[model samples]
Target: METSFKIAFISGKLGDVDGVSLEVDKWIEVLTGAGHEVFTIAGLYTNPLQSISSDKQFSLEYLRFDSTLQHHYEKMMFPYLTKHPTHLTSGTRDIIVEEMMVHGKELSEDIFQIIQDNNIDVIIAQNTNAMPMTLLGGIAVYNLLSEYKVATIFHHHDFWWERSRFSQNRIEGLLNKIMPPSDIGSEHVVISSYSAHILSSIKRVIPTVIPNCENFGKAAVLDNYNSHFRSDLGFDKTDILFVQPTRIVPRKRIEDSVRLVGMYGRKYPEIKEKIKFIISLYQGDELDDSYIEVIKNLAKSEDVDLHLISDRVSSVRILNNNGERLYTSRDVLVNADLAIYMPKWEGFGNAFLEAVSCRVPVVVSTYLVYKTDIKSAGFDNLEVRDNYDDEGLLKIPESILIDMHQILNDSEKRIQMTDKNFEIGKREFGFKMLSEKLNTLLDSYSDEIRASRRRLQKSKKSYAV
Candidate 1:
């Protein structure tokens, strides 16, 4: 690894409850630890960047997508963006193509400024290039990388081809150019094998798999965290803690967690009142606000002890003036009796991986990534399908109790499961493993650039003679 290079991480929104933001932060930790300078440029960021750098690190010159002409382009193309096979009238398709041509030029300029200002030796573009949510953002990145000989690693979390929202767009020209590893001087990296396979089918670019992982500090539980955590949250030590460490987003299908808890209470009447389902984060309907209302109604009707603790927890641990010690997401995971992760769709389930890493049993939905990638790694848990399974809903909490008893009563079983998972996670998602893959990709890019420069120098010398 070249320790002296300045690496820049670019994203549409690099901070918040989203998976991309969380994964980017983990990359920052790994990359910075290896002695490379790191910078962030995003439309949104909640993390403090004082440690990253004061001068070189920059945020979006314009933060909102609605501000740019790109938003209007996507808005007008929505009718043609549907995945269902339908013939768009020629007039509509022509209008959409014309708009794309105009926005493409404006987008190119934004990207050029970001690259020049940061003096970015290499770019780690996070998910923006993969998903066309900001279509012009993808176009901008593609244009800049194609023109400048900058080394880039497109950290693809989800591809436009996977999602239905983008499948029918009339702008195939733009999508083909911007999506994945095509038409850009970049290496492609997907978070799971399934994404890598799908990307390979759509684009000639075969993505390197660099799955997500929890940080070093997140692995071990703090010794006294639970005592203070319970006290602060007004729960007794014996309260059954069911933690859902994800945002309140519709795709997350959080109602499933409520149903799981309610069904568990009905089956195991003994621990009914003792169970507390805590949602440790919030994502307030940034896309569509209706889902938030639906979740609130579901929580209320189910009578589940659901707590949204976003206000209480920060990225760093601190104490309030009243001497109440605040906690991070790690502290919540450390104290959890069981972690419910039932996302209907996920790029990869980082929460499930973190739960197993922290020695907590998990109740996970069999999302594509888990079914194909994580499940094969030997994770045993309550696995549900896309929708609620009546049997799983009724039996999973009891399963948690059985596992809890084994963890507390049988030392050997606990050790076997935890040690097995740790080994599996390290093999698949550990820092040591991922860093080796990352540096290998960067080295190949470095070699190509060096070769091109040498050839250019030789040509100039011959001309002079």
Candidate 2:
């Protein structure tokens, strides 16, 4: 019989306009290409409007988590928990446990039934185990995995420990149980060496490092895109598009991007009217209204041509009722003159990878992850430090503009840089590179399965005899 594993890629929200959604879609492409049927078990979805048909061998069930309900529970309960390095009191712990059990029972039942009904061989629990966005969802997945002994691959993108928002919560005990279980019949995957090392050190769980990869082999053709996109956005053909392909979050440091462009525009009077700094995503995490206002004030003061185009962009391409084609984020990257990725923290920095894949020169900030891990790998780009004084800011953009002019002027130099970056990326973050590591992991997983099955058989025989 032909052996094809039925894989359920589970997440909090699978089909949204976010990095996680983009990453999951890429994995589906890889999994489906490898001949495994891919399905999504998500809180929300924005792609492939129809669920997996019953006639098809694969299936995905949507376990919708009500955002309003989650918000209510969090507001009602989270305040009483310890903040910033959250340790819980006995009273709060009891309440958290009660809620986990209540939601876990229903979640576990549904998951178990789905597994049995579909003969699911394994589950790729994406970030749900790492992030406590849905505490009950984690509990449910944890309970089902333990009771059924199902093979699970917990693909951790970011851990709750890495974020400040989850610093103090009443769910520490539950988070410990599920935020990646450290036992034999399962495997774990982390996106970066930094995460892998930290998780192993903290939880004593060895996880395989699978860096997020991009497909650069397929060239990004820019035929009608430039003209069409320019016309759509009301930009002239001569306009210099400086794209900040990230959300308007505090951590993203979008003000720096606006400043970068504004400084450039001011320094180069010849291109003053042509520079446009476009932020492609909507406002994020309303907790930091001050930072949002800072970006606005900075842009206004610097005379930056800022465009927040969140309303127009989405994860998937679609034609509206009026026959307007909505473009994906990839389209934005393809047409960008330069890409800015100046985030304070990133697990793997997929935006950097995307920029390189698009063959665009980038201006990056020296984020901790990049400084410690990526710099040593020998990938070269126009980069700067975090702190930017007035003089320093003025100098940095001038240098970048000169570099972009050179990159545009010198075809040989541009090719050399792109080629070198591409090779380095392929060595580290290419799909095939990850696939090789995954293949070995799968070998180990198969051995684990065989050993487990034999042990169960021996126990059964011994009891029978």
Model 2, stretches more than 4 Å misplaced? Answer: 1-3, 49-66, 80-93, 224-227, 283-291, 386-398, 408-412, 449-465
Q: Model 1, residue 339: what's the lDDT?
A: 83
Q: What is the C-alpha RMSD of each candidate to the true structure, in Å?
A: 5.1, 4.7
User: Model 1: per-residue lDDT, tens digit, 394-462?
Assistant: 224456545544564476876677677777776777777767876777676776544434443454456
Kindly report which residue stretches of model 1 are placed more than 4 angstroms away from their true locations once superposed.
Answer: 1-4, 62-74, 79-107, 168-173, 217-220, 223-227, 284-286, 318-326, 384-416, 449-465
Residues 1-465 of candidate 2 have per-residue lDDT tens digits of 333556777776766666677677667766666776766667666555233443432222323444654554555446532233344578876885686578766776767566555556677787877876666677767775687576778889889877776756666666777887776678899988889889999889899987777766654546664336667877777777888888777778777677777777776778788888888776632246666688888999999988877766777667667776566666777778778888867887877887788777778888877877677778878787766576534225467767766775587887788778778876777778756776677666875544434444554456553
Task: Quantify all predictions' global Cα lDDT against the true fold.
Answer: 0.70, 0.70
lDDT of 2 at 461: 58
Measured on C-alpha atoms, candidate 2 has an lDDT of 0.70
lDDT for model 1 comes to 0.70
Which 10-residue span in candidate 1 carries the lowest summed lDDT?
392-401
